[model samples]
Each structure stands twice: as C-alpha cells, then as structure tokens.
Target: MNKNFTLFNVLPLVIGWIGIKYGINWLTIIATTVIVSRSIMSLILSAKLHSSLSHLSETVRSRYRAVLRNPQLTFSVAIINMISLALWGQEESLIILAIATGAYFSVRHQLLRKT
Candidate 1:
C-alpha cells in the first residue's frame, strides 16, 4: 500500500511524541508553531490559487455534517469511544479497542473502495 503523508497526518504524531520526551511546554510550543505554519501556508496557497476561503470552509462543514448525519456511523463511533473510556484503566480493553477500531476502519475503507 502507498503511504500518503501530509502536514495534518505526520506532524502531530512526530511532534507530540518528541514533546512528550521533552516536556509539556515543549509540546505545546512545537504544536502551536506547526499549526500556525500550516495555517499560513494554507492562506498563501489559497491566495495564489484564488480559492475562496468560504468555499474551503463550506467543504469542511459539509463533510462534518455528512459524518454527523450518518446515524449508524455516529452511534458506532460513540459506542467505541464509550467502551474505551469505560475501560480506561484496563490495558486489555485498550488493546481490544484498538484492534476492533482498526478492523472497523479497514473494512469500511475496503468497502468504500469497492463501491
């Protein structure tokens, strides 16, 4: 499979892990800097491409609404999160949750691709 990386994809994990190694303050500072940089780059690209900010925002808004509108998906995710939260103190629960969550996403992705 091909791995696609973007600012939103890779930066947070790398920076957050590094920050954890250093300190909470370092994490906040690095995360804020990265977010600000990404935002500025987005603005610059949008200006160069003559894309309307409202159009971009509308696309994101619609996607959020689409996800919220899917009752099955919304309830499934809520149940998953609730299970994880309920078993918050148990390592086994987390392991099981991760496996189940990963499988759910993988199956969904495959089904979507075929459709």
Candidate 2:
C-alpha cells in the first residue's frame, strides 16, 4: 500500500484508540460521523455519475465504462473484510480492520480525484 494512503487510514484509528483509552466518546463519534458523511457523499456522486452516462457520446461512454469498471466490486471486498473482522479474534480483527480501512481510503481517494 502507498505510504500516504496507509497514513491516512491509520491516523484516524490511532486517534480513536487514544479516545477509547481515555474514555472520550466525542473522538469516536467524530470518526464515525466522518465515515458516514463520506459514504453518503460517495453514494450521491456515484448515482449522479451513472445518471449522466446516458448523456455522453458512445465513444465517451465506452471509455467511461472501461475506466469505471465495477465500483461495486470494491465495495464488496470492503464489506466482506468488515464481516470477517466481526468474526475474527482480536489480533485478526485489527489486521482486517487495517486492510479494510486502507482499501476504503484508496478507493475514496481515487474516486475523489476522478470527480
């Protein structure tokens, strides 16, 4: 994984961990709020993009389809990893969480840049 992406994924977790240690609910709440907001924004943007596809020329449509491929595939992996985290032991869950967060950041960053 790229260092910057990894850093982006890990930094929030680290802050949340500290909050947990200190019994600070606001930090955890803030993190959850950010994640939820980002997810909502992504959903809106994706819906708009898909709706606009019909308006593009055939060549552009083909190029866009090639570039976009299937974003749902990425979301599927993230969902599976999350489910695994719930089923895993503490150490294993942490690893799964890290991987999932990395994937989330990577996809979110890539899509943001494209838009």
TM-score of each: 0.32, 0.45
Report the alpha-carbon TM-score of model 1 versus the true structure: 0.32
Backbone collision tally, model 2: 0
Judged by TM-score, which candidate is best? 2
For model 2, residues 1-115, the per-residue Cα lDDT tens digits are: 4674344334445555566678786775554444444445545655565556446676766565565565675455446434433432223344434544455455444444553
Find the 10 residues in a row with the least total lDDT in model 2: 84-93
Q: For residues 1-115, write the lDDT of model 1, one tens digit per residue.
A: 1243335435544564566566665664564455434435544543433333234455554553454343474235435443533433224334444444444444334333331
23: Cα error in model 1, Å: 4.3
Inter-residue clash pairs, candidate 2: none
**Per-candidate clashes, comma-separated:** 0, 0
Clashing pairs in 1: none
